[model samples]
Target: MRAAVYIRVSTDDQVKHGYSLAEQREACCSRARILGAQEVTVFSDEGISGSTLERPGLNEMREAAREGRFQLLVVRDPDRLSRKLAHQLLITDELEKCGIKLEFLDFDWKDTPEGRLFYSIRGAIAEYEREKIRDRMGRGKEQKARQGGIPINFDVFGYQYDPETGKVSYLEHEKKVVVEIFNWFTSEDIGANGIAKRLNENGIPTRRRAGRWHRQVVKQILANTVYIGLWRFKGMYIKVPPIIDENTFYRAQEKLKEVRRLYAGKQKHGYLLSGLITCADCGNTMTGAYARWWGKRERRYTCNKTCQGYKNEGCRPVKYILADALEEAVWNQIQTWLMDPDRLAREAMGQIVGQNDPREQIMVINKHLASIEKGQEALIDVIAKGYLDHMDSIEKKLAELKRRKEKLEKRKEELLLAYRQREELFAKIDEIREISESILRRLDDLAFTEKRSLVRALVKQVIVSGRGVPGGNGLRFINVTVLAKIPEQKISS
Candidate 1:
């Protein structure tokens, strides 16, 4: 007789109960030998959970069993196969189909109805125990966060943790690197790639001593607020010693956001108005591309309906507009706006005042919702008073009420979100107004990304009209319409 012994132990099981894979393997092997099996194979999965059947050893054992390599499969306990009842039955059924008998050294009641019920109960209890342990650990961590205590398994770069005192202190050398990264990004306007290249060129080691510096690593270091003495854990912020000042941190954040917005999509050609430009014909946003025209590479913008998944259902224009001419025209118009600070300020202030108050609308919706709830309660009372004949009509009215309630609830959420965004929107308008002069002075000296950011902040959309034939000296009939970022107000009729 040939026999295969399987053993498994999870990390938590090993830590809590001192259960060893070796112990299970030895017991199963002894049982196999006592059953008079001459050839025995051992399969063991260590530090792997029994809730899944993806274990390497278990898979190999199943393959061998299917090959008729063993007459019997031996495990120390039923759970050594799987902690799930469904998985246990599945594995056992698969082995039985392959003409291999399963033998559990701890129990021989697998064939009985009572044993199957007991096995299912045990599996359920094991799963419940794992869930309870996970929940308890989560609650403990959240409690520690609320109490301002350091998390047990917390690990972050640029800081050293003292386990005994539960204190995190700045690593002096790493702290200097962090400050330098921020300064290069915010003050010098160096991008993440350039910063990473500089760090690697200087032979500076990453947090993991041997790891190479990466652009993503530099970006993460720049984005982390931990250097500003705040440890954010489970929605709680714990105060620590500061390494970077608030002003530098916030400026870096603003620069990052500006860069993200400027080059949001595929702007590989670095088109000035890639995301901001829209085709007046198809109403679809234009995408930047390079096309060869008469043996010359020409950068152009075209309606991106095909790329946007519209396929054959979009406007196909005869000719694409030159990128340089369109961008130059838009830039001149922005320059005109920048030259008039008074007009720009007045227009921005007008938009701000014209914006509707979302709070008032929310109050009105709430009042209507209260009335609906009262009507629903009255209908329920009428139905409860043995009004069985009105049940069908009442149900129809109730469903309609529910639909309206849902519609109003969704509207309320939208209004609330807009209300929350109102402050930030107004602040942006104010900042644009305040910096109008400074921006005009540096308009010519600004970098490509900076110019793009300025244009995106000030202009809502650039509607390009009329297509021109390629190979021409310039656009024959290029008309660019610039829409300023003005808030639209509802007109009372």
Candidate 2:
């Protein structure tokens, strides 16, 4: 007869409760020896959680059982098999299906109905007890928070947390950096990346003292309201030492919003009518093209078919419109609309045509996503509190919550995209009348980059008609039309 012994101990179980694999092996092997086993094999998983089915030693034991390498298996206790009740029953069923006998020193193994009932009840009680323990630990943190205490040790860059006292204190060096980041974001024309680079050049150490300062870390510092004395903990904002004033923090937030609304992370190209021109003859969107002829470098808008890597199945006679002529025409048209707010409002009001508002559906998705995030935070809170003894169950719960969150977030993005253009158009209309009044006074005086941004904000696309007839002199323009976005207020607030 061949026999197998399985033993397991998580990191916490070994350190806190003194559960050792060597001790379990000593006892399980002795039990196997008494069972008249000629050959015995021992499988052990150390520092790995039993709440999951992905243990190395446990997998080897299951495989050995299936291959008939062991006709009998001995475990010190059912908890050694798995902390999860579902996994315990699954492994037990799998072993029985393979015709292997499972024997636990602390548990009876019988094929009778009463034995199965008692095993399932005991597994349920163990699982319930584990949950109660984690719940108690989580509740303790909440109770501490309710009593006006700082329970967690993770402080932001500008603050230091003492675990012994659970009190947060300001670190002078890091607080100065945090103040500088906020000042740069609010008062200077520099972006987050520029600030991060400046910090790295100054040899600034990160909060962890691990590596160079990251743009995300800088952004987080600027965005955190804790700099103004409000720290978010378990959905509650506790008071912390203020690193910066409220006005500076709010200004930084506004600047962040303005940056996102304008550039949206994409670098601006030099073309004025980029991604906004259509070839009327071939129904192809025109693209900007730059070419040097002799001593002259010229920019023009041409049909997509004329570009390299694209098949030349374009109009019978493809025409290239000079960038200067097309831009001047479009800019003049935009200046006219901006100068006349009424016409701009009328034209742009119904321009963006979408089926549903999507705001209601988006609100629903946001609520669902919030619920999923709350569940994830609760699980993380327990794990973060050093509850690694039952970490497998928490990990499983976190994974499930994250999967649901990703699905909801994906749906929210789709809905947001569907409503982006229309909402932005209407939103622009709401503020355009006053903005255009000021902007029109200096429209032509705007720089090339500013002009491109203005053109992108106002104009949707340009459609030019007729092809250039190869005349005696050169290619000549036939006609040009500008479709400027004049979003009007259609829906009520």
TM-score of each: 0.54, 0.53
Per-candidate total of colliding backbone pairs:
0, 4
**Cα lDDT of model 2 by residue, 145-198, tens digit:** 877788677558888998888788999999998888988888888888788878
Question: What is candidate 1's lDDT per residue for 1-493, written digit by digit as tens?
Answer: 8999998898988888777988887888898989889999998899898889899999999888766788888897777898877898798778866667778887764657897788778777877886898899889888877888886655777788898888888888988999899999998857887888788779988887885677778778878888788878767898778889999999999998887887675355688887887777767678787877678888887774432113333455444778887787777777877787666756666765667799999999999999999989989998889788979899889867866876787699999998888777667766766688788877789999998898887778887766765454456665667787753211110
User: Which residue pairs in candidate 2 collide?
Assistant: 348-486, 348-487, 348-488, 349-488
Model 1, total clashes: 0
In candidate 2, where is summed lDDT lowest over 10 consecutive residues?
Answer: 484-493
Candidate 1, position 407, lDDT: 71
